[model samples]
Target chain A: MTVHRPQPPEDPDLPERPGPAGTPPRIPEPLSEPLSEPLSRADEAPWRRVHPVSPLIRGWIGLLAVAWFWGQNWFEDIILAVEDPGGRGAPPMEGIPFLGGVAWLLLVGGAVLVLVGLSFFLSWRFTKYQVTDQHVNVNSGVVFRRQRQARIDRVQAIDIVQPLLARIFGLAELKFEVADAGQTAMSLAFLRLGEAKRLRNLILARAAGLRSAPEGTGAPGPGLPGTGFSGTGAAAPGSGVGPSEPAAGAVPATDPAASPDSAASLDPAEAPERVVAAVPVGRLAGSLVCRPLTVATVVLVIGALVLQPVLTEDVSPLVVLPFLLGAAGALWKGFSSGFNFQAAASPDGLRMGYGLLDTRHQTVPPGRVQAVQIRRPLLWRPFGWYRVAVNVAGYGPGGDGGEERSTVLPVGTFADVLGVLSVVLPDPGTARPLELITAGIDGSGDAEGFRTTPRRARGLAPLAWRRQGFALTDTALFARTGVLGRALVIVPHERTQGIALEQGPLARRFGVCDVRLATTAGPVSPRVVQADVEVARVLFLEQADRAARARHRHDRDHWLEENPHG
Target chain B: MPQEPVDPQGIAWTRVSPKYAAVRMAGWAVGTAVTLLVLSVPLVLRLAGIWTWPPLWLAWAVPLAVLALDLVRLSLIPRQVRAIGYAERSEDLLVRRGLLFQRVLVVPYGRMQYVDVAAGPVARALGLCEVRLHTAAADATIEIPGLPAAEGARLRENLTARGQARLAGL
Candidate 1:
């Protein structure tokens, strides 16, 4: 067995490819036989163009603009001609010699069509993509040529998006999200759905540093030296697989033959995936009904109806039109994006599929999740529904078009939430994980060892004084806050970017402070608000040491060999 | 006066140069002069008999109020500068700032993405530079302003070295 250190590219012109001669065995073989056929042969014939109809599909927007302008002008010209039958008013194109109005229209329309077609052709000619074992590169742009290349290992998530237009043509788009926030590093748009899936699998497998194909017959061997029995194992008590003695019952062995779905005809090159949670349409609709925005919208509409008779006739319906449209639009966006949400656990990481018209399949790799927040809206408490979001390093800041791609579970039962949590973190760093999580969610006031906000905090947070607190385990910190809309944010000690203790003048008078744990730029922001100043200071100092120690313990970059499931 | 949160940490915090207060006062003076110059236009117009829409007292009142407020703020420069201090620990760097809303941030060296040494024209003339430590988190940008140029360079180098030594992936 040999260990391969990730070697930096030696030259600017030529990056060091992983699968060349004399390289380590683990990284090379999987590249050759990716998917059904030899993808290496396809890779050798590099710079493959996207689907031929890609330009036409993308050019529809431009086509629509042109058609709109032409239609508007054409209608005005015909109407003007009708109003003045004897050509008393000269047409706009009258300066041109000998051409009738219909002839001029045809000529100009043909010219516009030619220009649009030429530009589309040039765009199609210039745009090209290449996938090497080391990098995924895309070269595009007609005027200002741009070349984007993201390292295969740096890919944080891969999304397969099939918009209604593209889906009609049996095509999909591959979006590569790197560790940089809010930017798709590279996109190969309009590929055959099957090809896109295969390409995504190839990239994920290579990223995981797998020796065998992703869906090979054998289970992943104990490849890394210090994986299952590392000294840090004791710290991850929730994982249940103890370091000194592995618990067989807690972890289902990765035996494909033993699994019931082994008989299903799965793609040979894809990993055996198990669906962890699926939100039904009925539940999804119910969850949406309770949202604060939806409720407010409903109230506004009802109030408008109730006051209709008493209100003055001078009040126009258009006055309230904009607000109604805005609110309803927001609700529709939430509903569509979360239409058929499904979360699956695979060797690569957590795979989620959602969206109504434009279906999206996003795969967030293991170990990339910085923090997780399980939130229960006030109305959702009765149904026992919780929404889970995370702080992934790359997917932030309008990455989901103001619709949070960070949400791993949009709406799920408590059991479903735990299942997703178990897969994402694997180890909650506590012996009694269920009780601790339950306390963090439903219980308050020092339950399950949580340090609740002191009585002095009543002045600062009157309603949430009892619940605004924090709890710590060996591997992670749990900060719970809010009374009406409860939130429990869990930040793994290793992932904590910084710890801060903040105190305002009012809080200073009350001898209270807030402790904040900064993670990546996403939805989950861990903060213990309105705590005793003395306790906050101690926790702040202690948290720094804990984070440093946690970082020291968990250093493995190649997560595939760890066998998180087993 | 409120207690400083850094008291319990027992870490020796390095204070910025005293000249920073002078720099800040000078900046405030320039800003106030420009503001007063722009604001006195209405007063000049009212007094010159060219325009009397705004009452003469009202025009005069605005600039006087701005000057008075600026004077009070300018006096607190030294104390605000004193409140801003940074401490370098074995595993992390701690930055504390703000007089009324005191905040102390402890950023682990391993979490640092990069170190930036920036000097504005005013600070550059005064031979001072600011050091900024950027992490993956957007909110974790730790800025330690008003250091001597040489000290700032040294801190940047030290932080960059430490970050590389204990570098962890996002």
Candidate 2:
């Protein structure tokens, strides 16, 4: 219960503790004072408070929600009164006792804000997080008093999220991807952007099992046993200080200037990274314009605006306002999220920076990617544009941030797609990866060893039968489906969660079955649709064996051991 | 005649206890009755001179059709129970279920997060329990029902041990 004030890591008053190199030095809480009980080994790490303005950021979001729900009706009443002065005769506020309606609304709104602000302030006062070598603990909740801890070894990926408001305040939220699927084990909200970055680095460094020392040099050092045998710590990718000297092993094409704003970028202190994909604004806009939904929305709006006055006298263009609003929201979301999309490969797996108003920087660690899918929409085929999405464990269903979290490349050319894919799946388990990928994306009907749907499946798929195919490589399974909007999903054998063979009544008659390779919840679904019944059966058995064998080859638990570079 | 589908690997499969058919039928009977009562609300309202929407005949026909549907479902319950089977391999467990829409799922031990043994009141009354294998992928979950309670516990233990032994962290 003793209050411990925060101090700089280099404080001379605190005793020095030797720790992993490249980890931000920590000033352990003084052991001299234990107010009520004996200090446990885990409690040695001081429970640091978040930034003071944490509550303001959190409460603002809550306040916006409240206003959205209540203010809309209030505004409508005022607008109705103003528009038709003779209808109600009196002011909209006349019916209220003592206080006018506006005055009452303002009073209620102010009270609500005060209550929300006070509660948030109290919660922020109680909320504190601790980081030890083995665990990251977050204790919060004034009434419920919940304590959540994520084991350092169980860390999957670390994400630094900056919403529009948070960005304005120069603060970020640190979200931890732990062993649990679809749930962020722990999140430390409203830390200074720089502090969040440093904390994430320290945690990743510890998770990689790197050795540390007080004021240790930020260099790629030897890791503990059963990990970092390569001395590069290439297993976890971009964990630890990340080769501060630029040793030049795997990360080629180092272009730190790819992003315009270097000062505002994430991991400013980290080693140089290989710029794999930097989407141009023109390409992103063009790609979006080519989408069927965009076309439909544009046509709908134009038709409503132009034809409404010409056709019916009573029908107004405003009749389609709801549809237009919905379409605008979707389009704006897509446009803003994909703005300035940049993906780079560093010692830390893949680092992606995106969003116009709310920028997010996420690091997907090595071996964490379960599946990768390259998609080409029908309209985008002419431009040869492709979008790449991945399935990573712990990212959760639909991704908390939206599809942008899973989408490595929002929209890019084939070369850009391949560049991003190379960074994601370093060892694609196929020697002829380019040809295989090319075939998977564009080729149809028994091209490059892919087995297409049998002629009998023509009745079932009709348009897509010829394009539908599957190819099993040494380390991955590729399923290609769709005719107009082609998609190729690649699921690494080792990452496959489970395999299933589905035979519906109609498919049974067609002598075909769908082979679904189960992966973590994300955009990429590794489903081999409408394969010949015999082929699917064989695939089911073979894939099971392949997955088992692949699992044996991988050190799944120790992600910091399997050196992709090596 | 169409050839009956068989497991491609020809592995011996374990069938659920036959008593599950009765348990399922009982559960379904209660569910169907509730659904029929709910479906007959419109007819009852029409008869009581409270509300009128579709003609009187249509209102009565809806519940009758639901009754007919439930009868068909009741007839298929035993066959569906017979169709459910599971097999444990060296490194993975295979579960196959369904009659017309058949599916065979193979879940590797290394990928399994946990194992669950659950039994509803009806199932418990029949002294039967179901074993569920959960993986990181929600869709990959496999549930094997109609095992004796003791056997379900044993299966859960066995699966848990295998999963831990092959603990491949997601």
Candidate 3:
């Protein structure tokens, strides 16, 4: 292995060698290296496979599901045979008289287990991936082979994932969040945890346009096609239990979607590649408990439980079942999705990673954030804690309501919220971003140039009447509304998709209107509802002006010096 | 003498075609008649001895109920048409509409992905076309109705031109 210092692009005078005609072209890694040499088709690049144990780890869920089905079938027959000696329906073992029910059950369960295990092993052998300077490529499938390549420049975020099973073996998966609106994110699962971390850093460094130099250390970690086959599955010892190595020629395989167990042994948690900020576990738990939705769910459950005794015997379980499940689901979702929230500033923009059993890594570029919402629930106001969520392009609505993945700050102080927002929006081009943000958050209508809803709108929006207002700066539009859970969304004009004004019969009669700034489908909704009609109209026009000037700067020569005349 | 309270926002307003009010009202009338006819046919046929299982007068209930709603919509169409307005700012397009719960939407020309001009049978007969503009946001589709066909085309061309210019600058 050689230590290669990153270099700038080479001079064009050098000779360039082209690869073989028929094979895939060898794309060079970032501009740090000289482009004088052409990559050889045969050895320069090749598809790589994951760890041999990957298939079992990836396919473990399917295997267990099959085993569970078989186990349930036998358990019923065994129970009947043991309890009801002379039942009307004969037990399953009756047909196999030589072996009693117990023996038959073991035989079938073992056979099914072995068959499923073998299939997972074979499936793992087929899946493979490769990373070039320009793109990260994955070639996968057993029956229907498929190849996917995401350009390095378009990579939005990369998540390092460790499912319980993979975690047990000290393995991690690299999940790529791309900026292609129509495509689903890509995942390279089940690599050595150390290797996964390094790959994440290497890929990010390249994607940030700081392309690393030509081949140094030469090893494509442990998972490239040829290297993975030769590297001993020593990491497998951590989870594979038995030390019996597979025969040299046996094809190794991998799987995904494993159900993780509770914390068995917490490794003195490895430092996040670059920790910017991490939400304390205690704070996360406290915030989840105090959240309005969490409290409402818990109260509903308790109320239902209290009524359980009065309901008839048949209705008792029905009443208890759904309420208990609903309460548990909400609490678990709140805790798991937000657990261990960590935010770090990277060259690629602000990077966030959260989740308990199924950890996710999301990288949001600066320009990709369409809007930002800072919200403070009524209960959270006492403690000055807020939640931050953003609308990001190409991320899409995959969660329950696009809330789960879009959450950048599940819980934070006023300062933490602004810190995260700064990373996303960077420069609102205002002299006092902090003042604008704070005024937008808890400030009254009189603060700055924020104009509130009219007194006539009082009856229309009785709860949020005076609170509804909008303040615009050169680069951002701030819309403040909501009585109980006050929300202020700051949208940069360049990112604004469209602005709309709405009026209902009552609002029209009140002589007020609503103006909403629409962004892509995500958590943050930037809208000023029930503003004085005149105020809304002015806002509409002013926003257009600000957005246009801001857009001219953003879409035009952003790098060039600012124009003095305009 | 005190003047009426001033409109604070002060955006210049451009009203929709005056003929559009009658066209919209007529449209509501046609829609109501179609709905009533569909509902009344079953009962009318049963009463005339074409069918018997379901009673005839029950069908009349729907049209009668529809009459009240249709009457309100038809009467409100004029106010709604008069209320609709738009203003073309230097960088974005502003559209305002609705009588009671009024709405004003500002769509920057650069953000507009495309512009569509659509006129159904009724609108076409009135020589008016609805210009619908789309932005990247799923909910940010704005429609400007009751524009003369020529005006709609001209707006579309101007919008496309602006969209290109802004995008190039970005």
Candidate 4:
């Protein structure tokens, strides 16, 4: 592949240059030429080596595993029939007297071996990946060829995974998650380490270039200047290239009077430059290593180890050794896999790269982000940081035939969380500026600037244990009460669907009621917030009115557009 | 300060038929009876096996007790019906119902996506129907039970038309 060196313009303000003055400007090279020519078929287009895992074979193996465990009783019954041919201490076998004993063992053993062998062979053959200038492509499958391609622009995030065995073999798997088109998000997996990193950088550069470019192109321009838009050849040093300048419908003007700093920041090369300096390896590892799933897995393993001997009478205690060993190996693998997690602010959005055996890389673009959530668990309080996740449309499965969506950052520190949030949210700084509204135990008086609703105030001192309520920095949304646990939710005015006012027999006697403001994100089920029935009625009406007004201003269609990077 | 009771009109009532109260009461009765009958089956068989006279009477008495409980519950249907009501205006739809406690839910017609009107055999015989107002909220669904059939249909039509108009304006 040919590499292009960008030419620097002659400017007195620029620092001394190391390269020769008269050399021709080099155009950055594309990763690989598209297979536009008919002659370049699969064979000629650089034979991609892949490890195959056929879908049919994978299904069969999964079936075999299930049958082995679930049909253990059937297997045991067959053994009993052979041991006691005359049906002594055995349930009567009603059919198929001939070849019953030998057939059973052959069927079970044959099925198990076939499934395991096929799986291993397929895993070895079909998994091959190629990273190109525009997209990352993965080809896998033995019987049914499955090929998945994710454009650099649409790739939201990349994850690297290195299984213990794969790490031993010096191999890593790269997972490229693209924004979902419908219920499925495109993914590319399994690439060599060096190739994966190089490809990751190429995709990151393209994503960043797309972000910095005028929004209409959607396609990422080459890293070199003058390649972004047609007829706008390389501008001289210091040409004003404000985004609005392109909107004025003026022909490209070559002027050498714009600020260099602004122009430099827009450059595609500058995309990697900014990210390279701030890649938070430690923060990324901290985010991925201590996820809830990891904790749950560890707890399950410990429980299984403790119960193994007690649960099985016939099996000797030695059988538990393999189970313990496997659990320990898996735990160690999980830890090592996330140890190298790294997240960087790339031009397109944010790029999270990590893995132990198979490296997974992800790139998220800003346009694909639907919403941002910042959560602070009690255990994470001492860290003075919050975990951040983005709600993106068509990104994950919604459990009952609904669209699939997923969070961008499953975990991250406050600064890292804020950094990613700024790119995805319209106003990144809004969370920091807002004061948190907390629900009190009673309807009594509150801290300065906070007040309890009238319903809660009625039994203030006496029934304080049951009532809790508060509004935020602004009274736009309120968390009134939670009987079991406190929950704070932001009910956007536009997103509010309705209001519910509930009064129990006891509450009615006390002239107190609870009101809930519902939103599209989820139902706001606040309990025990006290207010008079009349006040509750009025609050419901007011909230509904605000919701209607807000809904009017929302543009649902904007979220439907396909994001090039997730 | 003590607050005066808010007018019932101010509270939102579900757009449902009075027959829903009857159906709910019937369902509760059936559920209770079935539960008691299931619990008595083994006892009856065991009683028949040993000490037949007094045990058989006790076994027979269990189902009778369940039937009596169901009858008492059925008697509360009218009061339950009185507690349920539906109110619809140009801007919003309200559904209110409760036994011992009252709940008033308000769903703005503009935010409503659709309204579903349905009736089971018993409700149809009683000339009543149930209406459910669907919104974008993931979990919040406003259901009004036991409305006269004609009123339920009219409310559904109005809600649908208003929702369409609001959505079009957007």
Highest-scoring model, TM-score? 1
Model 2 regions more than 4 Å off? A1-44, A61-120, A213-269, A563-566, B1-3, B45-56
lDDT string for model 4 (A41-138, tens) is 22232324322222222244565565566367566766776776664534444454525744765687567656655565565445555445455566
lDDT digits (tens) for residues B40-153 of candidate 4 = 775777666854445666777777887787778678777767766666665776666666666666777776766789888777888887788877554457887777888878
The candidate with the higher DockQ, 1 or 2, is 1
Could you tell which candidate, 1 or 2, scores higher by TM-score? 1
Cα lDDT of model 2 by residue, A322-378, tens digit: 887887788788888887777766655677877777777888876788899999998
**Cα-based RMSD of the predictions, in order?**
10.1, 9.5, 13.0, 15.4
Predictions' DockQ, in order: 0.68, 0.66, 0.45, 0.34
- Which pairs of residues collide in model 1? none
How do the residues B1-170 of candidate 3 rate in per-residue lDDT, one tens digit apiece? 11112222656777779778867877777888888888888878887888887755566676787888888888788778887887787777877776555566778887787789998888899899999987767788778899998998998898888888875321
Candidate 3 iRMSD in angstroms: 4.0
TM-score (all chains, Cα) for each model: 0.85, 0.81, 0.70, 0.54
Q: Which TM-score value belongs to model 4?
A: 0.54
- lDDT, residue A383, model 4: 49
Least accurate stretch of 10 residues (summed lDDT) in model 3 chain A? A261-270
Clashes of each: 0, 11, 26, 59
